[model samples]
Target: MRRLASGPDILLLAAVWIVDVAVFSTLLNRSDSPSGLLRAPVVVGYAAVGAAALLLRRSHPVWVFAAVWLHSCAANLLPLGVHPTAGVLVALYTVTASRGEAVGALAMVAGFVPLGLTVAAEVRAAAADERITILTANAIFFTVVGLLVWGLGRWVRANREHARELERRRLAEADAAVAVERRRIARELHDIVAHAVTVMVLQAGGAQQILGTDAARALRTLRQIEDLGREAMGELRRLLLVLRPSAGDEAQQPVDGHQPGLDDVDRLVGTFREASLPVRLGVCGAARRMDRSTDLTAYRVVQEALTNVMKHAGPGTRTRVELNWADALSIRVTDDGGSPPRRASAPSAGHGLLGLQERVDVVGGTLTAGPTRDGGFEVNAALPVPTTEPDRARSGG
Candidate 1:
């Protein structure tokens, strides 16, 4: 079962109870009047009851405040020489902290009512005018003290609410980041699987067609297929390591320690050529290295474009892959639509194109893909190049 009151609550109750009893008892002893002796036991009993009610303040703040406030007012009417308002103040703090500012203000005002009435009665019964001044002074004192306690409670409540809002926002951001990462992983897997399967299927068909007529060529095609399959498996394993790494693997690099980037574009083109796609590679400017992300994006752009060519346009299509390295890297892959017409596959969700667009946007680059004026498809991407320190200095000069 959950505990209603915590350790700190019990400690606070004990502290308040002790102070109230001690103050009430000391005031009673200082009084030489017979009325103080006669009402001493009653005062002690009242303090005990107020303390008991305070134990439930956290669970039932409003009711406890009412009980303690009324008890304090009644006890003040006696000749105990002091207002036994310790419990009432404690209850008021609890009410404000739990119920909120508006309710706390109302409770504070409600508490002052009976208190004001008691003070007014005492003022009227005073024999001298100066005695009325003392009563008013005491009333003002207690009122100021109550406001301070209530304000403290309001401050505490404000801080608590602020902390809760911060935690909620943090959790929301974490969930959004996780969703973005999942989409990113999905895109990577799609590029790998789609490109690999397309090449392998085409190679298998070509090998079968040439097996009896050209055994040597067929053997080469079969070997290329085996190599592509292994590369695809390796990339898949790298992704798995990223998704679920063991304790020992956490600090280690990816399975191959190298991700496919611009440097691997040559090898990429070779794979498609072996699969029987007539692809031409061209570079128009001085080649330079790029940041890893931009490099990977460039490679994927070329890869997905070629994969789509083979999948939609079938083999024997003449494809051109060009790279222009100037102020920025420009990649263009265009296919002149050719033989076997186009295969009628199931409708595509277009995840490849969409994922490529998102990736280009992340790298502060632009990408466009559509059919050309001729009966062919084209994909163009411009990736920004980061300026080296020497270039920056030269430009500054």
Candidate 2:
């Protein structure tokens, strides 16, 4: 019932009914001819039916327009005389609003025929001087009113379509952004877990090999493995915290607590040395504090390159990690060790290089990783340094 007659529907129905009553009353009071009086009841009944048809206009706009239009024409044809009612205009607006431009044009043309005919009838009954005046005035008045109503409906329909199109574009952009962010998060997780576990594996293997021959060294290796495990767990927890929504006191804690930066690269190198890899670190040019993101990317590049060396170059490889700080930071990790040793659980997804490339690109940097001419592998990256106000002031314009 509510769908059939909403609040606006009831109000429209009442308005149309009132217009019908007013038109009928005016016809009865204005005319004095006996023939006109006799036809008055028929015209009044026709107007009532046309106005009632407005109730279904929203559901069947074209059909309602045709029905109301035919009834209006029949009423006008009667000798008694009838005037244009609100029902005709209402039906015309509904057709234009719902049926689009092509059908609305047809309805407009159909409506014009009756109006022209009514004007012609009025002209035939007037004196010669008044005939021309009445014809011109009625033609101009009806044409202007009809076109205004039709144009208003078309304008409203166009605005509604435009709004819907904007909403669709907004939702599509949002979905694309979400997909890109998911890929980024996946890459970050891979880098963190892969590097940490690889070191742990090397330490465990060293502990196993030296257990019978050297008890003190084996125990030291085991302790190192425990420390690596605890560090990995802490990093994993931080990553997980980002996914969970916080409440109360937890909300105040930072999501990233002491994220690794360039300063931590020395510590990272120490861990690899403990795993029995002979690694060298070289720094050239002056070192200065860099932006958080650039610092993080530089650290990850070194970390990933060293991890790859551990996996592919095997133990006892002479590896070199170089950091050249100039206009941009240049990182290169190279190993003299040959092919990788086969292992049962050598964690591989083939996404390590790809993830490194993505991280480099995000900081407007470039990364190159492939075999070197020396029968070894090399990973090189160049990351741009972000300028700060202090640097600008010191350099001078």
Candidate 3:
């Protein structure tokens, strides 16, 4: 609530004052009686004060209503008779609009009290025949107008509350969308950087061991490292574009030519094998077409699982990856326990499984990873595939 009146409040006060003064002057003009003319200035002065009270109606609705009520009663009791004035009705509207139903109901009854008393006084002073008619008409008219004004105020209050509720809902939805996007960006960073760095470390170590005895093999390993490094840089550039892209780059391709999916799993396994981590790939059932998100999630599950084996397992550890295409695509990557590494295991930040779970969830899949009974580790995932698409096209078919 405002402590001081606003522009609209001043305008409303001016409008009501003009209306009240005009009506009072018109009644005074029609009556040529000397007593009515003498009281004219006093009535206008009191009406001015009531209209001015409207300025503070929003801040002090109850008090404003009381002042206006007194002004209306004085008009009737002082023999310059007027029905309940516009000031009293405006005050009633403010009370109901600002203070709500229970308080507004009280204000309505308070407003009618003075009018009732003035009417009863007039009926007693009049002739016996005219008393009943005056009482009935005034009572009916005033009650109906009072209820309509109160109801209009309540309608305005309800509309304001409804608008506020819609604004709150819109803000909440925006916040939730921001949180989800941050998690997705975090997941992408972990998957791309972690896997590439792990492969490079193993390749570097393998090259160092054979550098002097077999120069040719060392050279080949270094070339693979150079190629892998370039690929990682390209992927990072693509991810960066997603984070903060220039207008020109909006039409550019994502990273290299095409995004990696299930079809690229074989090449992914080949990359790990080149780094001296023994890997074998197997497939069963006819592969079916999948949506982009589900295809990418399936590939990532295998990539993350194999990357984990290289990071935490021994040097001679062997990994097997299986893809079972069915109504739902089922994937499994298992690593056989091997001789302990000659050096300390690589450091782990442990975001692999956590990110994998979130990615799998996005595509409506389930992922589980744990040590097997045979002293090996295994990651298993089942991703649902939409059957409404064409069968996956195989090369040279």
Candidate 4:
């Protein structure tokens, strides 16, 4: 069944039919030819059928075009005293807009042929006094009008396709950004949990061994384990809170009310000290403040390096963390002990290192990790310290 026309479609159909009736009535009434007067009803009926086809032009453009084209040819062949109807023009525009240039070009040719033929017939029947002038003017007028309608329809189709292409590209870019952010969050979560758990395990092992011989020291180790667990939980909460959409004032403060930075290195080293891993922190050149991202990257690099030392190098390993502040901030974590046996269930050796490399790359830095010449392992990174014009002015250098 044909779907019902909308209010706008109905209005359009009524308007086109009214215009066709008015134009045909005026033309037929003014004509002196008996044959034209006799064909008046036939012309009106064909015009009405063509006007009704306009209702479905947008939904079924090709069918509407076919119907209107046939009507136009019939009206022309009958030699009715009428011009190209409004319905024919509407159908031509719909076809070009819906079907592209190739089909549009064909419709234009098919539509204009009958119009040209009717004009030629009219020109031949006219008195010889003004035949050439009338033929030239009418031919120019009709051709220009037809081309304009067809061009306008093609332009609308091109614009619509351009807009759709832009929308598709925008959606693709948004999806890519989301995937990158998720990967970053995953790296952070892995680093936080893995490092904290490694420390807790070492502390727990120490506490178990010395529980009877030195109850106080073992108790201290147990307390350190508890602290590490709390810290990890706080960091995880903060990270998760950062993922949520912020509302007003709640988003400004860190969820755990702490932002880890280079200053936290001493406290971080203290935990490993308690676990009996001697971590010596060495600072070279003057220390200066860094932006939060670079600062966090620096801290995470050390944290992951030390965690690896604890996991692979085992206890009693002498680890060194050196920070060199210059045009760039350099971090070096080294352990003198060679690689020890890692547990079968431990994470792959490359996972943590790969995560660290990604973090460094994000901050436009470089990282290198391998066995050192002294039969040990080392992880080193150089992170650039961003300096703005304000800093240069403040320092007066």
Candidate 5:
């Protein structure tokens, strides 16, 4: 940082100051031949003060103004330099860029007072026997410069404040979006694992009633229920982790590995099949591979769609699951006919589609669910295939 601060970049601004002094000194000499008061050493002193003011311009804007004021008074009184006020202009610019409005305003008034006095004194002395036009002109110039400096400072501060405000608003919007995503995720867990576990417990009990005659089959059914409970817990843990990366005691671990893919669809469809629901599963296009997140989303979308079917369309409904892996992966689940054999004990359990919609949105995909013309419920979903490794890497990474 020290090296950067001391680097040659600042020499450019220093050079401009030096050039201004040389030209103005030449003009002063041309306009007023060496009145013995205008000596080389005195002119050099004025330049030294102006250069020093420029050196600490950013760090000490008020000090720069003070130094330039002293130099300006000397130059103008003897008219030793034609451009007496350029160093003051530089100081004004420094205050504009760095200082706050109230402080800059104080510095402006402080600088203008001494400056106007010096010009007024010079005018009184130089135009002793002349009209007062020169004095009025000098006063007007001082007032204009004071107003200009104050205006510049105000403008810069306003712009800086506006930029900061915009940044704050943008961050607020991002936080709100994340909060909304978390709420939707919570709702999905309530419907999926919570409902699935309840159904599994009930199914396991039913299997036990005929346990003696079909003892082996009953055990197999019990095991399937245990497997499902574990699966739901695993999915639940993963969803919790994704929602809360920083969750500690509250942290629910993410499902460690990727979400199950097309291969796992068979296992999912088989769960209902074992329960004696007629389920037809279909696949099209290449069974393209994908990241775990999309697989999870696909899993959840299918899971919720099916869950809704069983909840609303009822038990013994014929369900069809289709996976199309063409340009993008598409999932469709249709219940051509199945109203719960009996009305469900719970009627409000069909709201899982809200969670499904959020899952699809996270992947920049889309999902839609509604009744079909053929007297069935249909869920049609399309998830964009992450076409490149970079995109997949970003989501996975």
Candidate 6:
């Protein structure tokens, strides 16, 4: 299980506790130096309670603050003067920071009100010559301590918000990665099983046609059918594990035999032609190549861009596909609306834009999607392309 509280954050709070304890202990010791609490067990006990309360201030803020406040008004039965009172400020700091704005402000006010009253009482008890001096000193102390705690509060708040934003971005990336993997697995299952089933059906039909007259041939066809069936079962088992494998099974499963990437753009365009979309594939700049991540990112950008076009643009529109092989892999898929018929799902029904944005961003790429001046929805993504692997992309088989 994850640790309940983060160690570093707690340690910072612990530092506040130690400083508070030290400040009070020093003041109490000095205040009782001549007429020591060591001379009286009762005063010594009260002082011990006050100091320990400082250490536990963050852990038990309310109780510790209240105990300190009561002791502040309880005469020499308490520790010392204003120095011992710094513990309440530490509690206020913890309370304000850990709780929300409402509770934090309320807790701060609770601490401040008592502190103000006690300081005012000390001012009243001072001799006339030292009255202004004592009041001024107390005012400065409050100012310094209050500002210090306020600065600490701001730092704590800023760090907390930054940490939250980092966590949110991480979680979003993980979700998108999982989604991409799931969709790829689905496409593989569609391709693999569909082809296997088609072959199995044809073999079964042929075997049925001459079962009695061509018994030997029929047996051969049946054996072939059994082979295909076992292959289908193995593929199905692997796909199921990919979709939702038990933990140990997940570790040993073979990866899918799919390397869909940028080099396959021509074949991808051929499919749109099979579906009767007037799509064109164009390549510019010197021939270059990319790693699997870059290639896959480039391909997915095109795939999503085309998918968007099919769903958003006119069917009769002439689509232009441009893949610039340069410092950046520039993808521009725009359409002039195809012929015959046009139909599409709602814009929000597709998460292609969100998915594409995530893909490009991961590879330090940029994507811009909107309608062009010609009333055509256009997508432009500039992805990082490497220079050294032209051979691999050219030899794509």
* lDDT of all predictions: 0.72, 0.71, 0.72, 0.73, 0.65, 0.64
350-371 in candidate 1: lDDT tens per residue? 4466656766765678999877
Evaluated against the true structure, the overall lDDT of model 6 is 0.64
Which of the numbered candidates is closest to the native, going by highest lDDT? 4
What's the TM-score of each model vs. the native? 0.52, 0.50, 0.50, 0.52, 0.55, 0.52
Report RMSD for candidate 3: 18.5
Q: How many residue pairs clash in model 4? A: 0
Error of 2 at 29 (Å): 3.5
Q: Model 5, range 244-329, lDDT digits (tens) per residue?
A: 53211221224652335555667877887776767888776565555445666887777677777776766688888887776788
RMSD of 1: 18.0
* Candidate 3 lDDT, 102-203, residue by residue in tens: 998898788787657656655765689998997888678768888898888899888888898998976555444434443454446446656777899999
What is residue 148's positional error in candidate 5, in angstroms? 1.7
Per-prediction RMSD in angstroms? 18.0, 18.8, 18.5, 18.4, 14.7, 13.0
Pick by TM-score: which candidate is best?
A: 5
Candidate 6 residue-wise lDDT, 1-397, digit = tens:
6443466645644554455444433344445565543434444444456555665555666676678767655632333433345556766676666666776667666666656655665577679898899788977777677657755765687789889999898766556555665455444554666677899999999999989899999999999899778767755764564464222111111267565787678888778777667888887766575544556678788877777777766354678888777777788988654443233222332455765675566556899877654556678999876556565433211
Off by over 4 Å in 1: 4-7, 22-35, 74-83, 117-127, 213-397
Q: What lDDT score goes with residue 126 in model 4?
A: 70
Error of 2 at 353 (Å): 30
Task: Indicate the worst ten consecutive residues by lDDT in candidate 4.
Answer: 388-397
Better of 3 and 5 by lDDT: 3
Which residue runs does candidate 4 get wrong by more than 4 Å?
1-5, 24-41, 79-84, 213-397
Residue lDDT tens for model 2, 278-334: 889988766666645567779889988888888877778889999887788899998
TM-score, structure 2 vs. true = 0.50
